[model samples]
Each structure stands twice: as C-alpha cells, then as structure tokens.
Target: MFDGVARWWDGFELWLAQQWFPVQFVLVAAVLLPLCVGMAWVIHRGVEAVADRLGRLCRADAAGNGHGVVDEGHGGRPDAVS
Candidate 1:
C-alpha cells in the first residue's frame, strides 16, 4: 500500500514538473496561496479565542469575582489598598 502510494505521488510530481512554469506558478498563487492564508487566519483566530478565555479565567481568579468582570483602569488586577 505504501509503495503504491509512493509510486502515485512520484508520477504526480513528474506530471507537475512537466507543466509550464507559468501554469504552475499561477496554480500555486491562485489556489495554494489563498488556502495557506485562510488556514493561517483560522489558526490565528482560534489561538486568540483561547487566549481570551484564559485571560478572562486568570482575571476572574485574581479578582475573586468568579465572573471575569474586568474593572476599568486596573487591567484585570485587583484593587489596591489605600
């Protein structure tokens, strides 16, 4: 099975190499570029969401509020004693 897959891949690569350079470049730019960018965007958004949730959790813990309600000017830190 692995050998067959490798052989198929090799054939596909050879066929790709035989294509005109411009065609290959256009295919990559038109198809692969957008695909990579979209995937990156999705990953970045997912990471940002996780970070936001973690930040809220930390803030909630620090404030002892349990609700993650970040107050103004303190930046999620608990109020200081006068």
Candidate 2:
C-alpha cells in the first residue's frame, strides 16, 4: 500500500536536496552576512552624527528658539531642530 509513495519520495528527495544545496550556501555566505555588516555600518555612522550634534547642544549657551544665535565658541555649529 505505502510502497509506491515511499519509492517516489526516495528518488525525489535526493534531487530536491541537490537543488537546494547552492541556495542555502549563497543565502548565508553571500547575501545575508554582507547585508548585516553594511546595515550595521550605516547605523553606527547615523548614531555618531546624532551624538555629535547632541554634544554640541549640551556644550553651547544658546538663547531664544535655539536658532539664529551663532556659536562662535564651537565654530558655529548649526542648531538642532525641535
């Protein structure tokens, strides 16, 4: 009863495994790994820029709406948006 189905699966499983061999290799070693590294670099740069801007704000002595006032001490850093 189950003999025909079992035989078919035995042949098909080998072919399916061979086809998926390269797909699994490329997904981990070529695609996902590099994308993870690139995304991390982008995030690091973005966070650094925000931190630098915040540091400038903390060190300055701005009056009014934190705009127009020139920060001569810090080489005129631009005001952060509200």
* Maximum-lDDT candidate: 1
lDDT of 1: 0.78
Candidate 1 RMSD to the real structure: 6.6
The superposed Cα distance between candidate 2 and the true structure at residue 14, in angstroms, equals 15
Worst 10-residue stretch by lDDT in candidate 1?
73-82
The C-alpha TM-scores of every prediction are: 0.63, 0.46
Residue pairs in collision within model 2: none
Task: Tell me the whole-model lDDT of each prediction, alpha carbons only.
Answer: 0.78, 0.71
The backbone clash count of each candidate, in order, is 0, 0
Against the correct fold, how does model 1 do in TM-score?
A: 0.63
**Per-residue lDDT tens digits of candidate 2, residues 1-52?**
6999999988876665676777757655786788999999999999989987
Which regions in candidate 2 have their CA more than 4 angstroms from the true location? 1-23, 62-82
